[model samples]
Target: MNGMERISSFIDSYIEDDEGLLNEILSEAIKNRVPVIRKASKEFLRTQLLIKEPENILEIGTAVGYSSLYMSNYIKPNSKITTIELDEERANLALENIKKLGKEEVIRVIKGDACKVLKTLPDASYDFLFVDAAKGQYINYYEEIIRAAAKNAVIISDNVLQDGEILESHYTVEKRNRTIHDRMREYLYKITHDKRVCTSILSIGDGMTVTIKLSD
Candidate 1:
Protein backbone atom coordinates (compact mmCIF):
# COMPACT_ATOMS: atom_id res chain seq x y z
CA MET A 1 0.00 0.00 0.00
CA ASN A 2 0.95 3.61 -0.49
CA GLY A 3 2.09 5.79 2.40
CA MET A 4 -1.26 7.47 3.06
CA GLU A 5 -3.09 4.19 2.69
CA ARG A 6 -0.84 2.56 5.22
CA ILE A 7 -1.15 5.50 7.58
CA SER A 8 -4.93 5.55 7.32
CA SER A 9 -5.11 1.85 7.94
CA PHE A 10 -3.03 2.19 11.04
CA ILE A 11 -5.10 5.13 12.32
CA ASP A 12 -8.40 3.40 11.66
CA SER A 13 -7.30 0.33 13.51
CA TYR A 14 -6.83 2.37 16.68
CA ILE A 15 -9.94 4.56 16.32
CA GLU A 16 -12.93 3.51 18.43
CA ASP A 17 -16.49 4.75 18.18
CA ASP A 18 -19.83 4.31 19.94
CA GLU A 19 -21.84 6.35 17.43
CA GLY A 20 -22.85 3.99 14.68
CA LEU A 21 -23.80 6.61 12.11
CA LEU A 22 -20.69 8.63 12.74
CA ASN A 23 -18.55 5.57 12.40
CA GLU A 24 -20.31 4.75 9.17
CA ILE A 25 -19.82 8.21 7.71
CA LEU A 26 -16.17 8.26 8.70
CA SER A 27 -15.62 4.93 7.06
CA GLU A 28 -17.50 6.13 3.99
CA ALA A 29 -15.40 9.25 3.82
CA ILE A 30 -12.30 7.11 3.78
CA LYS A 31 -13.76 4.65 1.30
CA ASN A 32 -15.27 7.22 -1.06
CA ARG A 33 -12.30 9.57 -0.61
CA VAL A 34 -14.49 12.37 0.68
CA PRO A 35 -13.20 14.87 3.19
CA VAL A 36 -15.35 14.86 6.31
CA ILE A 37 -14.70 16.21 9.75
CA ARG A 38 -12.74 13.86 11.98
CA LYS A 39 -14.61 12.01 14.74
CA ALA A 40 -13.35 13.97 17.76
CA SER A 41 -13.67 17.37 16.10
CA LYS A 42 -17.22 16.63 15.03
CA GLU A 43 -18.27 15.61 18.52
CA PHE A 44 -16.67 18.64 20.15
CA LEU A 45 -18.47 21.05 17.84
CA ARG A 46 -21.70 19.12 18.32
CA THR A 47 -21.40 19.52 22.08
CA GLN A 48 -20.71 23.23 21.68
CA LEU A 49 -23.89 23.64 19.68
CA LEU A 50 -25.78 21.83 22.38
CA ILE A 51 -24.50 24.34 24.91
CA LYS A 52 -24.70 27.51 22.79
CA GLU A 53 -27.83 26.82 20.74
CA PRO A 54 -26.61 29.45 18.33
CA GLU A 55 -29.37 31.29 16.51
CA ASN A 56 -27.23 31.53 13.41
CA ILE A 57 -24.11 29.75 12.15
CA LEU A 58 -21.78 30.38 9.22
CA GLU A 59 -19.72 27.52 7.89
CA ILE A 60 -16.85 28.20 5.48
CA GLY A 61 -16.77 24.74 4.00
CA THR A 62 -19.53 22.34 2.97
CA ALA A 63 -17.79 19.18 1.88
CA VAL A 64 -20.80 16.99 1.09
CA GLY A 65 -22.58 18.98 3.83
CA TYR A 66 -21.48 16.45 6.44
CA SER A 67 -20.56 18.85 9.22
CA SER A 68 -23.44 21.21 8.49
CA LEU A 69 -25.91 18.35 8.76
CA TYR A 70 -24.09 17.15 11.82
CA MET A 71 -24.52 20.60 13.37
CA SER A 72 -28.17 20.67 12.34
CA ASN A 73 -28.68 17.48 14.25
CA TYR A 74 -27.61 19.25 17.42
CA ILE A 75 -29.08 22.69 16.89
CA LYS A 76 -32.66 23.80 17.52
CA PRO A 77 -35.06 23.12 14.66
CA ASN A 78 -35.59 26.80 13.98
CA SER A 79 -31.96 27.79 13.83
CA LYS A 80 -30.33 28.42 10.42
CA ILE A 81 -26.93 27.73 8.85
CA THR A 82 -25.22 29.43 5.91
CA THR A 83 -22.37 27.39 4.44
CA ILE A 84 -20.02 28.26 1.58
CA GLU A 85 -18.26 26.02 -0.91
CA LEU A 86 -16.33 26.75 -4.12
CA ASP A 87 -16.35 23.37 -5.83
CA GLU A 88 -19.43 22.94 -7.99
CA GLU A 89 -19.30 19.15 -7.97
CA ARG A 90 -18.96 18.98 -4.20
CA ALA A 91 -21.54 21.73 -3.77
CA ASN A 92 -24.06 19.73 -5.76
CA LEU A 93 -23.27 16.63 -3.77
CA ALA A 94 -23.70 18.61 -0.57
CA LEU A 95 -27.08 19.90 -1.72
CA GLU A 96 -28.21 16.39 -2.46
CA ASN A 97 -27.05 15.17 0.94
CA ILE A 98 -28.68 18.04 2.79
CA LYS A 99 -31.94 17.31 0.94
CA LYS A 100 -31.77 13.68 1.92
CA LEU A 101 -31.20 14.71 5.51
CA GLY A 102 -34.34 16.92 5.35
CA LYS A 103 -32.35 20.00 6.36
CA GLU A 104 -32.57 22.05 3.16
CA GLU A 105 -34.60 24.71 4.92
CA VAL A 106 -32.15 25.04 7.77
CA ILE A 107 -28.82 24.82 5.91
CA ARG A 108 -28.15 27.08 2.93
CA VAL A 109 -25.07 26.24 0.86
CA ILE A 110 -23.72 29.23 -1.01
CA LYS A 111 -21.67 28.47 -4.11
CA GLY A 112 -18.54 30.59 -4.55
CA ASP A 113 -15.24 31.55 -3.04
CA ALA A 114 -15.73 31.67 0.72
CA CYS A 115 -13.80 34.90 1.13
CA LYS A 116 -15.81 36.71 -1.53
CA VAL A 117 -19.13 35.25 -0.42
CA LEU A 118 -18.41 36.25 3.16
CA LYS A 119 -17.95 39.88 2.08
CA THR A 120 -21.64 40.13 1.22
CA LEU A 121 -22.82 39.11 4.67
CA PRO A 122 -23.81 41.96 6.96
CA ASP A 123 -21.47 42.78 9.83
CA ALA A 124 -21.81 40.97 13.12
CA SER A 125 -24.43 38.62 11.75
CA TYR A 126 -23.53 35.18 13.03
CA ASP A 127 -23.66 33.62 16.48
CA PHE A 128 -21.16 30.96 15.49
CA LEU A 129 -18.64 30.65 12.66
CA PHE A 130 -16.84 27.50 11.59
CA VAL A 131 -13.69 27.65 9.47
CA ASP A 132 -12.87 24.48 7.64
CA ALA A 133 -12.00 25.45 4.09
CA ALA A 134 -8.62 25.84 2.37
CA LYS A 135 -5.83 25.59 4.89
CA GLY A 136 -3.78 28.35 3.28
CA GLN A 137 -6.64 30.80 3.64
CA TYR A 138 -7.28 30.24 7.33
CA ILE A 139 -6.11 33.71 8.24
CA ASN A 140 -8.37 35.36 5.71
CA TYR A 141 -11.26 33.24 6.95
CA TYR A 142 -10.35 34.22 10.48
CA GLU A 143 -10.57 37.90 9.58
CA GLU A 144 -13.95 37.47 7.93
CA ILE A 145 -15.23 35.26 10.73
CA ILE A 146 -14.25 37.80 13.32
CA ARG A 147 -16.03 40.51 11.38
CA ALA A 148 -19.14 38.38 11.10
CA ALA A 149 -19.30 37.20 14.70
CA ALA A 150 -21.79 38.85 17.05
CA LYS A 151 -20.94 39.72 20.61
CA ASN A 152 -20.17 36.53 22.52
CA ALA A 153 -20.07 34.68 19.24
CA VAL A 154 -17.83 31.64 18.99
CA ILE A 155 -15.54 30.71 16.10
CA ILE A 156 -14.29 27.17 15.82
CA SER A 157 -11.34 26.50 13.50
CA ASP A 158 -10.70 22.91 12.51
CA ASN A 159 -7.44 21.25 11.40
CA VAL A 160 -5.35 23.82 13.15
CA LEU A 161 -2.64 21.27 13.91
CA GLN A 162 -2.37 20.17 10.25
CA ASP A 163 -1.61 16.67 11.40
CA GLY A 164 1.06 17.88 13.83
CA GLU A 165 2.91 19.76 11.14
CA ILE A 166 2.59 22.99 13.10
CA LEU A 167 4.78 21.50 15.79
CA GLU A 168 7.65 21.16 13.36
CA SER A 169 10.16 23.85 12.54
CA HIS A 170 9.27 25.84 9.44
CA TYR A 171 12.12 24.34 7.42
CA THR A 172 10.85 20.83 7.95
CA VAL A 173 7.49 21.38 6.21
CA GLU A 174 7.17 21.11 2.45
CA LYS A 175 7.72 24.41 0.70
CA ARG A 176 4.12 24.62 -0.47
CA ASN A 177 2.82 24.03 3.05
CA ARG A 178 5.36 26.16 4.88
CA THR A 179 3.52 29.42 4.39
CA ILE A 180 0.25 27.99 5.58
CA HIS A 181 1.94 26.42 8.58
CA ASP A 182 3.51 29.71 9.58
CA ARG A 183 0.32 31.64 9.05
CA MET A 184 -1.66 29.15 11.12
CA ARG A 185 0.83 29.47 13.93
CA GLU A 186 0.49 33.24 13.77
CA TYR A 187 -3.30 32.98 13.78
CA LEU A 188 -3.26 30.63 16.73
CA TYR A 189 -0.98 32.96 18.63
CA LYS A 190 -3.16 35.94 17.80
CA ILE A 191 -6.34 34.20 18.84
CA THR A 192 -4.92 33.11 22.17
CA HIS A 193 -3.25 36.41 22.99
CA ASP A 194 -5.87 38.82 21.74
CA LYS A 195 -7.66 40.53 24.60
CA ARG A 196 -10.99 40.65 22.79
CA VAL A 197 -11.27 36.90 22.48
CA CYS A 198 -11.14 33.98 24.86
CA THR A 199 -9.52 31.06 23.08
CA SER A 200 -8.70 27.45 23.81
CA ILE A 201 -6.89 25.01 21.58
CA LEU A 202 -8.19 21.50 22.04
CA SER A 203 -6.45 18.38 20.79
CA ILE A 204 -9.35 16.88 18.98
CA GLY A 205 -9.28 15.76 15.35
CA ASP A 206 -6.08 17.07 13.84
CA GLY A 207 -6.64 19.90 16.34
CA MET A 208 -9.34 22.50 16.97
CA THR A 209 -9.20 25.97 18.39
CA VAL A 210 -12.31 27.55 19.91
CA THR A 211 -12.54 31.28 20.22
CA ILE A 212 -15.30 33.38 21.73
CA LYS A 213 -15.51 37.10 21.29
CA LEU A 214 -15.14 38.93 24.57
CA SER A 215 -16.95 42.14 25.45
CA ASP A 216 -15.79 45.28 23.70
Candidate 2:
Protein backbone atom coordinates (compact mmCIF):
# COMPACT_ATOMS: atom_id res chain seq x y z
CA MET A 1 0.00 0.00 0.00
CA ASN A 2 1.06 3.60 -0.60
CA GLY A 3 1.08 6.65 1.70
CA MET A 4 -2.58 7.54 1.17
CA GLU A 5 -3.64 3.95 1.62
CA ARG A 6 -1.62 3.75 4.79
CA ILE A 7 -3.26 6.92 6.07
CA SER A 8 -6.75 5.69 5.26
CA SER A 9 -6.09 2.32 6.84
CA PHE A 10 -4.83 4.01 9.92
CA ILE A 11 -7.91 6.18 10.14
CA ASP A 12 -10.22 3.24 9.61
CA SER A 13 -8.36 1.43 12.30
CA TYR A 14 -9.21 4.13 14.80
CA ILE A 15 -12.86 4.49 13.91
CA GLU A 16 -15.41 2.46 15.80
CA ASP A 17 -17.39 -0.34 14.18
CA ASP A 18 -21.17 -0.52 13.82
CA GLU A 19 -22.94 -3.01 16.02
CA GLY A 20 -26.19 -5.03 16.12
CA LEU A 21 -28.60 -4.78 13.17
CA LEU A 22 -26.65 -1.99 11.53
CA ASN A 23 -23.59 -4.17 11.40
CA GLU A 24 -25.68 -6.98 9.99
CA ILE A 25 -27.06 -4.74 7.29
CA LEU A 26 -23.58 -3.56 6.37
CA SER A 27 -22.35 -7.12 6.20
CA GLU A 28 -25.25 -8.12 3.96
CA ALA A 29 -24.55 -5.23 1.61
CA ILE A 30 -20.91 -6.22 1.44
CA LYS A 31 -21.78 -9.85 0.74
CA ASN A 32 -24.20 -8.84 -2.02
CA ARG A 33 -21.59 -6.50 -3.53
CA VAL A 34 -23.53 -3.36 -2.82
CA PRO A 35 -21.41 -0.24 -2.65
CA VAL A 36 -22.32 1.57 0.51
CA ILE A 37 -20.17 4.43 1.77
CA ARG A 38 -16.59 3.56 2.74
CA LYS A 39 -15.41 3.50 6.33
CA ALA A 40 -13.83 6.93 6.15
CA SER A 41 -16.78 8.35 4.31
CA LYS A 42 -19.20 6.74 6.74
CA GLU A 43 -17.51 8.34 9.71
CA PHE A 44 -17.32 11.65 7.93
CA LEU A 45 -21.02 11.57 7.09
CA ARG A 46 -22.00 10.41 10.57
CA THR A 47 -20.02 13.24 12.07
CA GLN A 48 -21.54 15.72 9.67
CA LEU A 49 -25.05 14.75 10.69
CA LEU A 50 -24.16 14.70 14.35
CA ILE A 51 -23.01 18.26 14.02
CA LYS A 52 -25.72 19.58 11.76
CA GLU A 53 -28.62 17.43 13.00
CA PRO A 54 -30.58 18.28 9.88
CA GLU A 55 -34.36 17.94 10.01
CA ASN A 56 -34.80 16.87 6.41
CA ILE A 57 -32.17 14.74 4.69
CA LEU A 58 -32.28 13.95 0.99
CA GLU A 59 -30.21 11.17 -0.47
CA ILE A 60 -29.79 10.54 -4.22
CA GLY A 61 -29.05 6.85 -3.83
CA THR A 62 -30.46 4.23 -1.50
CA ALA A 63 -28.45 1.06 -1.99
CA VAL A 64 -30.03 -1.53 0.29
CA GLY A 65 -30.80 1.36 2.67
CA TYR A 66 -27.37 1.18 4.25
CA SER A 67 -26.44 4.85 4.07
CA SER A 68 -29.89 6.15 4.93
CA LEU A 69 -30.28 3.81 7.89
CA TYR A 70 -26.78 4.73 8.95
CA MET A 71 -27.60 8.44 8.80
CA SER A 72 -30.78 7.91 10.77
CA ASN A 73 -28.66 6.97 13.75
CA TYR A 74 -27.01 10.39 13.89
CA ILE A 75 -29.88 12.72 13.25
CA LYS A 76 -32.46 13.92 15.74
CA PRO A 77 -35.27 11.52 16.62
CA ASN A 78 -37.78 13.54 14.62
CA SER A 79 -35.54 14.12 11.59
CA LYS A 80 -36.67 12.47 8.36
CA ILE A 81 -34.63 11.01 5.50
CA THR A 82 -35.92 10.59 1.97
CA THR A 83 -33.70 8.48 -0.25
CA ILE A 84 -34.10 7.70 -3.95
CA GLU A 85 -33.01 4.58 -5.79
CA LEU A 86 -33.20 4.18 -9.56
CA ASP A 87 -33.10 0.40 -9.52
CA GLU A 88 -36.43 -1.10 -8.58
CA GLU A 89 -34.78 -4.10 -7.00
CA ARG A 90 -32.50 -1.99 -4.88
CA ALA A 91 -35.38 0.26 -3.90
CA ASN A 92 -37.48 -2.68 -2.83
CA LEU A 93 -34.58 -4.18 -0.93
CA ALA A 94 -33.99 -0.84 0.77
CA LEU A 95 -37.64 -0.61 1.74
CA GLU A 96 -37.49 -4.11 3.14
CA ASN A 97 -34.36 -3.32 5.07
CA ILE A 98 -35.96 -0.16 6.41
CA LYS A 99 -38.94 -2.13 7.61
CA LYS A 100 -36.75 -4.82 9.13
CA LEU A 101 -34.75 -2.20 10.95
CA GLY A 102 -37.95 -0.53 12.09
CA LYS A 103 -36.97 2.71 10.38
CA GLU A 104 -40.06 3.03 8.24
CA GLU A 105 -41.08 6.09 10.18
CA VAL A 106 -37.72 7.83 9.92
CA ILE A 107 -36.57 6.71 6.46
CA ARG A 108 -38.48 6.38 3.21
CA VAL A 109 -37.22 4.84 -0.01
CA ILE A 110 -38.49 6.20 -3.33
CA LYS A 111 -38.21 4.08 -6.44
CA GLY A 112 -37.48 6.15 -9.54
CA ASP A 113 -34.83 8.11 -11.36
CA ALA A 114 -33.44 10.65 -8.94
CA CYS A 115 -33.37 13.28 -11.65
CA LYS A 116 -37.15 13.05 -11.99
CA VAL A 117 -37.91 12.47 -8.32
CA LEU A 118 -35.87 15.48 -7.33
CA LYS A 119 -37.97 17.66 -9.64
CA THR A 120 -41.08 16.56 -7.83
CA LEU A 121 -39.73 17.64 -4.44
CA PRO A 122 -40.52 21.11 -3.16
CA ASP A 123 -37.89 23.77 -3.64
CA ALA A 124 -35.69 24.29 -0.58
CA SER A 125 -37.07 21.16 1.02
CA TYR A 126 -33.90 19.47 2.22
CA ASP A 127 -31.35 20.69 4.71
CA PHE A 128 -28.82 17.94 4.05
CA LEU A 129 -28.44 16.40 0.62
CA PHE A 130 -26.31 13.34 -0.01
CA VAL A 131 -25.39 12.43 -3.58
CA ASP A 132 -24.06 8.91 -4.06
CA ALA A 133 -25.45 7.63 -7.31
CA ALA A 134 -24.40 7.38 -10.98
CA LYS A 135 -21.15 9.24 -11.42
CA GLY A 136 -21.90 10.44 -14.94
CA GLN A 137 -25.31 11.71 -13.90
CA TYR A 138 -24.00 13.98 -11.15
CA ILE A 139 -23.61 16.93 -13.47
CA ASN A 140 -27.03 16.25 -14.89
CA TYR A 141 -28.41 16.16 -11.33
CA TYR A 142 -26.85 19.50 -10.34
CA GLU A 143 -29.56 21.95 -11.36
CA GLU A 144 -32.39 20.06 -9.71
CA ILE A 145 -30.20 19.50 -6.66
CA ILE A 146 -29.62 23.24 -6.27
CA ARG A 147 -33.31 23.93 -6.68
CA ALA A 148 -34.24 21.32 -4.08
CA ALA A 149 -31.72 22.51 -1.56
CA ALA A 150 -32.73 24.69 1.35
CA LYS A 151 -30.76 27.83 2.03
CA ASN A 152 -27.51 26.82 3.78
CA ALA A 153 -28.13 23.20 2.89
CA VAL A 154 -25.20 20.88 3.27
CA ILE A 155 -24.57 18.99 0.05
CA ILE A 156 -22.28 15.99 0.35
CA SER A 157 -21.30 14.06 -2.77
CA ASP A 158 -19.42 10.79 -2.73
CA ASN A 159 -17.20 9.00 -5.26
CA VAL A 160 -16.39 12.27 -6.97
CA LEU A 161 -12.88 11.13 -7.92
CA GLN A 162 -14.02 7.83 -9.48
CA ASP A 163 -11.34 5.85 -7.66
CA GLY A 164 -8.49 8.29 -8.40
CA GLU A 165 -9.49 8.74 -12.04
CA ILE A 166 -10.23 12.45 -11.72
CA LEU A 167 -6.56 13.50 -11.79
CA GLU A 168 -5.70 11.41 -14.86
CA SER A 169 -5.79 12.72 -18.40
CA HIS A 170 -8.72 11.70 -20.58
CA TYR A 171 -6.32 10.00 -22.97
CA THR A 172 -4.80 7.98 -20.11
CA VAL A 173 -8.13 6.75 -18.68
CA GLU A 174 -9.97 3.75 -20.07
CA LYS A 175 -12.66 4.48 -22.64
CA ARG A 176 -15.27 3.03 -20.27
CA ASN A 177 -14.43 5.69 -17.70
CA ARG A 178 -14.00 8.66 -20.00
CA THR A 179 -17.59 9.84 -19.76
CA ILE A 180 -17.65 9.63 -15.97
CA HIS A 181 -14.26 11.35 -15.85
CA ASP A 182 -15.39 14.26 -17.97
CA ARG A 183 -18.71 14.64 -16.21
CA MET A 184 -17.18 14.38 -12.74
CA ARG A 185 -14.67 17.05 -13.61
CA GLU A 186 -17.47 19.25 -14.84
CA TYR A 187 -19.49 18.61 -11.70
CA LEU A 188 -16.56 19.55 -9.53
CA TYR A 189 -15.93 22.71 -11.50
CA LYS A 190 -19.58 23.70 -11.47
CA ILE A 191 -20.08 23.24 -7.74
CA THR A 192 -16.81 24.88 -6.79
CA HIS A 193 -17.29 27.85 -9.06
CA ASP A 194 -20.95 28.45 -8.27
CA LYS A 195 -21.41 31.55 -6.13
CA ARG A 196 -24.24 30.00 -4.12
CA VAL A 197 -22.04 27.58 -2.18
CA CYS A 198 -18.69 27.04 -0.54
CA THR A 199 -17.34 23.70 -1.75
CA SER A 200 -14.50 21.58 -0.52
CA ILE A 201 -13.42 18.48 -2.43
CA LEU A 202 -11.63 16.00 -0.20
CA SER A 203 -9.79 12.79 -1.01
CA ILE A 204 -11.97 10.62 1.17
CA GLY A 205 -13.85 7.44 0.22
CA ASP A 206 -13.21 7.61 -3.52
CA GLY A 207 -13.26 11.36 -2.92
CA MET A 208 -16.02 13.47 -1.36
CA THR A 209 -17.29 16.98 -1.95
CA VAL A 210 -18.75 19.03 0.90
CA THR A 211 -20.69 22.08 -0.16
CA ILE A 212 -22.66 24.42 2.09
CA LYS A 213 -25.29 26.34 0.16
CA LEU A 214 -25.00 29.95 1.20
CA SER A 215 -27.95 31.67 2.77
CA ASP A 216 -29.55 34.10 0.35
Model 2 has a clash total of 0
Misplaced by over 4 Å in model 2 are: none
User: Over the stretch 1-216, how does candidate 2's per-residue lDDT look in tens digits?
Assistant: 988888889988988889898899899999999989999999999989988889999999998999999899899989999999999998998998899889999998889999889899999989999999999999999989988999989999999987787899999999999988999999999999999889999998789999999854
Tens-digit lDDT track for model 1 on 1-216? 866446655665665563555455546656889888886677789889989999999999888788898888788878999999999998998888777767889999999999899888988889988899988788777666777889999899999999888899999889999999998898898899988899999867788999999754
**lDDT values, one for every candidate:** 0.84, 0.92
Residue 93 Cα positional deviation in candidate 1, in Å, after optimal superposition: 0.3
Ten residues in sequence with the least summed lDDT for candidate 2: 160-169
- Model 1 global lDDT (CA atoms, 0 to 1): 0.84
lDDT of 1 at 207: 84
**Residue ranges of candidate 1 with Cα displaced over 4 Å:** 1-28
